[model samples]
Target chain A: MLAFVITTVLCFITYLLLTTGSGTLGLWSLEEILVGAILSLIVGSLARTIFVKDNFRMLNPVRWIIFIAYVIGPFFVAMAKANVDVAYRVITGKINPGIVKISPDLKTDFGITMLANSITLTPGTLSVDVDEDKNDLYVHWINVKKKALEKKPVNYRYVCGKFPNWIRRIAE
Target chain B: MIFNLIIYILLAIGVFFNLLAGVGLLRFPDVYTRLHAGTKCTTFGSIFICGSVILIGLRMWYTGSTDGSVLAIHTIFALVAILLTNPTGAHAIARAAHRSGVAPVRAVVDDLQNNTLKKEEEK
Candidate 1:
């Protein structure tokens, strides 16, 4: 029930965003809103179970704010730094490419997914696989540092630089 | 004039990174490294390009154009879609490559395979 409502709201918001200024009203016409509502309701009923299983905690506004802050803040900085690093490597042909395993130990599926996505999104590292039992991520790192491969307790700073912590805050 | 200049600069930077991504794709050694170049660089470049468009829309809105807000908002939706989808697609490609037996260049360990074996033994 809650999932249905959440999905409906989300879908409607997406519909509204996509259909911005298509109507006689300020943003949407009454007829368009009706059509959007019907469409969103159909979508919500269909995908509610898949989207929000039992994790209503993730629907919290605070987590969303934190996620927004993360994107605009540390993640942005990390991406810029990664772009510079990748650009240098591309220009100079200096790269030590290898795959290594890092154990993030995030329990929730959403947390693990977010971390994996973050790792893959940031340059120089691509998440190649995951150990489902132990929650370890095998990442293909473009410049494999000796410190990263020493199998030390996986430092979030070294592997993904603050991504795990931020993901924990948002999803876990 | 200043806004156009900034937008042009952003567009140039976006194009530059995209060009570097193409260069890296050709020059990099293997599948994994090539994926890095192909995915992240384009994503970053697209971000800047979309951002410049959003700026243009905002400037138009400030000049009393009603269509500007709609343009800006829709561009944001596109940006969000790109940001969300690109990395996941890259991850899928990387995982598929690894599963299909594409090893990294000069890799020292295969912990993923080791862990899978360990799990199988435990079962």
Candidate 2:
């Protein structure tokens, strides 16, 4: 609870700083800041309690820094590459047009969300759905792989794109 | 001068990503893939665009323009609304597509269909 309060305070302070400069808050702005702060505290506490009910392992600063770096680095890199590939395909009309399944060996829901977000952010791929039981992602790829690819209309891969590994580093 | 430069850069980044999103939507195959390109890219691109507007608002506020301040603040709220709603809407569309049986082009194993089957069997 103490940590939650600290986080809430920090979040409110950051919000204030980003939204309005320091030490010059007018009465109206002060009221806004106070309201925002109260809301932040309530939301922060609720979010912490609900999301971190069982484990608060993700709150570590080191893990967060590493995660941010991973997301901004390799994940962005993959997105860039995909963007180029997509552009080329669009210009040349070389897209294979297929859907493939990717089972990125992820344990947590956060990991899955990261992977899905990464894929969705990329230019040519769409994360269709997830199999909640086995935790597999149904992805629709612009260009399905040749060898591993079958025409069965339902393919899943353990390692299809560079997305899974990058997301693994970032979120898992 | 420096502030204007930052705003221009932000606008450029935002416009580039927005164009990418549009291009992806046009070029990508299938409904789901097009939706992916159309939604996420625009969301990211719009962030930078709205961010530039926010900076412009701050600059105007400093220069004592009430209209500029209002414009900037309203734009920020609009951006927030977009950010909150876009992805959730996209997810809903994708799920609808899957339920409607829009299978991946060359998919080998469909865990979603299998899951449905399993649920039916359990029932």
- DockQ (CA atoms), all models: 0.68, 0.31
- Residue B22 of model 1: what lDDT? 98
Q: TM per model?
A: 0.93, 0.70
DockQ of candidate 2, scored on C-alphas against the true complex (2 decimals): 0.31
Please list the residue runs of candidate 2 whose C-alpha ends up more than 4 Å from where it truly belongs after superposition.
A2-7, A10-48, A150-172, B1-13, B23-29, B47-51, B54-89, B104-123
Estimate, for each residue in A1-172, the C-alpha lDDT of model 2 and write its tens digit: 7557656876776565445532346413676687878988887786766545455566678778877686567665755666566556656656555545566778788878766766666656667777777677766566655676543434333233555665565555
Tell me each candidate's i-RMS in Å.
1.4, 4.3
The DockQ of predicted model 1 stands at: 0.68
**Backbone clash count for every predicted candidate, in the order shown:** 0, 8
TM-score of 2: 0.70
Question: Which 10 residues in a row give candidate 1 chain A its minimum summed lDDT?
Answer: A148-157
Task: Assess the local accuracy of residue A151 in candidate 1 as a C-alpha lDDT between 0 and 100.
Answer: 56
